[model samples]
Target: MSRVYLSLGSNINPKHNIREGIATLNLRFGQMQLSPIIESEPVGFIGDPFINLITTLETELPISELSSQLRLIEYDFGREDNAPKFSGRTLDIDIVLVDQLEGEHFGLTLPRKDLFEHGYMLYPLSLMEPELIPPGQEKTVQELWQQFPFPEQKLWLTEL
Candidate 1:
């Protein structure tokens, strides 16, 4: 089995959608390691705040098939294929890392670029796997979190 990390976020009906998303993932993947749910301001567009979190699961499926399944899950939750990149979403799921695999596989970038650029991605990942060294990177997740610029983008754990 390959260990896969995924980032999930939702702005529209976030509390409900996020919970539903997780439940769906759990049903499909059997079990998952979930980070604390957090709330953050929308990054690229004007919209409601988003509830975000990261999850890790073990899967026997290949990256291509896994990515395809995730997209289908997002669609089932009302994600629009043509929606603007920065717009609000019902559910947004991205493959952040898949074991030690690197570069692009199935058109998806491993160790997603957002992991370095967004606190929403890095913080939760660090929480889940502090010692994890992403593919092609020497720094551990904890190191990246420590180096993250504070006060740049605000995010807080949510009770929801």
Candidate 2:
């Protein structure tokens, strides 16, 4: 089984989308380790804050297949075909890590870079799995989250 970590976020009907996303993860992937919902100001496009959460699961599917499944789930959650780039969609699911797989050439190395760059991802992650260590990163989720400068924004404590 692959230890899969995914980040979920939405600005439209934030609460419902988050809950639905969790339900989808459980129904499609496997049992999920869901984090509390966090709210952060729009980073790229201009809009309302985003309700973000992290989910870790053990899946037998390959990483590529998992990614495709996640994309389909996004569509099921109301993602439009021609949605504006980063314009606060109904659901956004990003693969944060897939085991220790790495790449030397043009391919996806395990542990997505957003783990450190995006506080929204790291913050909730700290809450979910304190011992989570992204591939190639020495710091655990708790350590990284502590290092991150908590953005002075809103984050809701979502119940799963």
Which candidate number maximizes TM-score?
1
* lDDT tens per residue, model 1, 85-138: 989999999999998888888798877999899989998888878998888888
Reference-based lDDT, residue 134, model 2: 73
Winning candidate number (lDDT): 1
Error of 1 at 52 (Å): 0.7
lDDT of prediction 2? 0.79
Residue pairs clashing, model 1? none
Angstrom error of the Cα, residue 142, model 2: value is: 1.4
lDDT of each residue in 75-149, candidate 2, tens digit only: 988888798776977899988877776543124555777778888888888988889777787889899877776
Clashing pairs in 2: 39-155
Minimal lDDT window, size 10, model 2: 101-110
Model 1 stretches with alpha carbons more than 4 Å out: none
